[model samples]
Target: MHLLRLRTDVAELLLSTQGAAVLGWSLDTDTGRFPLLRPARHDGNGAPDETAAFPLVPYGNRVGGNTFSFAGRDYQLVPNAGDRYRLHGDGWLSDWTVEAATDNSATVALSHTADESAPWDYLARQLVTLDGYRLTLTLSVENTGRDTLPFGLGWHPYFPLTSRTRLTAPASSVWLEGADHLPTEEVPLPANLDFRKKAPVPARWINNGFEDWNGCARIDWPERGLTLTIDTDPIFSRYVVYRPDTARDPAFAGDWFCFEPMTHTVDGFHMPGMGGLTPLRPGERLEGHIRLEALALQTGYQRATGKDYPGP
Candidate 1:
């Protein structure tokens, strides 16, 4: 199926039906057009990861070894994404129905039932709206089962990673990944881990989660003379930063980086304080919003007088 397209004066967006994911978002400017999120690399037949952005619903991240104990009973999950743990959630893998669409807004819905590979029965919806230069994505999930289960919501958006791109975000702590792709321990943010000064992507591989995130981050692309700001609701207090290793995924090497605004850490079910999983009773719902604003920077002097101006 063809992806839905949305437009405004300064931006153009592509939304896919397979996962209700964002296929691509680009900014048009005087200098040149550039993608705010990484452009989609595959058709709907490929994995959600190939898209520019996708929703993290019912839960975000892995559940640890495909199993977790909740309210005295045990739940088993099937592994996804080549991991030994249950990755992402059913919403990202299932086809979503387009409930509504307009010039600058659209909504999609997905429903799931508890089965062998899935345990949580719920209904999820995503509403995407664009006003001027801001793109807002609001997501909600309501438990439909008779029993209660832990739930979380978030968004996975990949941004273009160029040589001069710098990211600035604030966080109180970080979870270092261990052998099994799970957090080994929690520690205070170190100098190297700090992004407050707009740091470049680390040369080495990084797949860690940050806790108590300030819910705001700025990504600047100097060469392109563009900047993008990301803002999320408090429900997304945790964030995951990931850049695949070249040897593992050469196709994605240095092309993009994911700054995932999530509600919990990977495999949080196995840890006490790390798990942000909220116990949702029957009929209960979890919801949140993420907004992105893209703007062009004045990297060159005034055309008439060749004079400089202040820049962000």
Candidate 2:
């Protein structure tokens, strides 16, 4: 696995060619280096899931039953990574080729051919860049298959979750998930799940998709005196928020949670309107960007939130 390091005076990033995952991202602050995303538990060399974030190409999330009918044709996907459904598409499991790299930016590319396991032929690319206190990840995919197929893109990022961590992202509705962790129905956001205002991450298990998002979110760490703002391209109108339970996931700890910016809803393949998956003919492409800005609370936190700084 080839690992690339992109560093600047204000920020630093580590990425692995394996799955094109971001191993870590942190900001240099006067107090110390503050982690923008969850730090890899082990060395920078590890599975993509252990990294700070990874790209979701072709599509993101699951398609029920590992089967779907598109354009009057049926397609089947084999379960990957030991999951019941073909989870998160192939980008995360396939090795990516580093096309270029610089001190603060890098581009990774991937090519996949049609097969029984995944019947979509496509070419994908991800560009990661860090400027000052901002980091942007742009993912693009082109349908290289003979038949027109639905395509989507997204990013799964693990962020540091503290006891006082608060999230503020506005969404119109939420999808209720079934036992299989797939969307069962769309319903109004519940009081506990409503993040229209800054609120703590729920203590209970949460694995659901939020729709009609404004393409923006914020996470504040009062204790650390840090705040992160997440902004996405307009194409990303949906997102998923997940927190695993210890009972189901042996690796579970309260230290981290995922905020996924997706172009389509989970299980978009089977949704009535195909959720939001865009149909792409040969040579057609779909793409979007997710941008994050890390800031020290001392400068503008009190002014923006109208709350006094809770210093370190």
Which candidate wins on TM-score? 2
lDDT (tens digit, per residue) of candidate 2 on 35-142: 888887688566668888899988998889999999899888899888899999999988999999999999999999989898899999999999867899889999
Model 1: runs farther than 4 Å from truth? 298-312
- CA lDDT of every candidate: 0.83, 0.89
- What's model 1's lDDT at 87? 84
In the range 45-125, model 1's lDDT, one tens digit per residue, is: 577888889998788887777888888898888887787878898888888999999999999999889999878999999
Q: Estimate TM-scores for all models.
A: 0.93, 0.94
Candidate 1: 10-residue stretch with minimal lDDT:
298-307
Please give the lDDT score for candidate 1. Answer: 0.83
Most accurate candidate by lDDT = 2
Model 1 earns a TM-score of 0.93
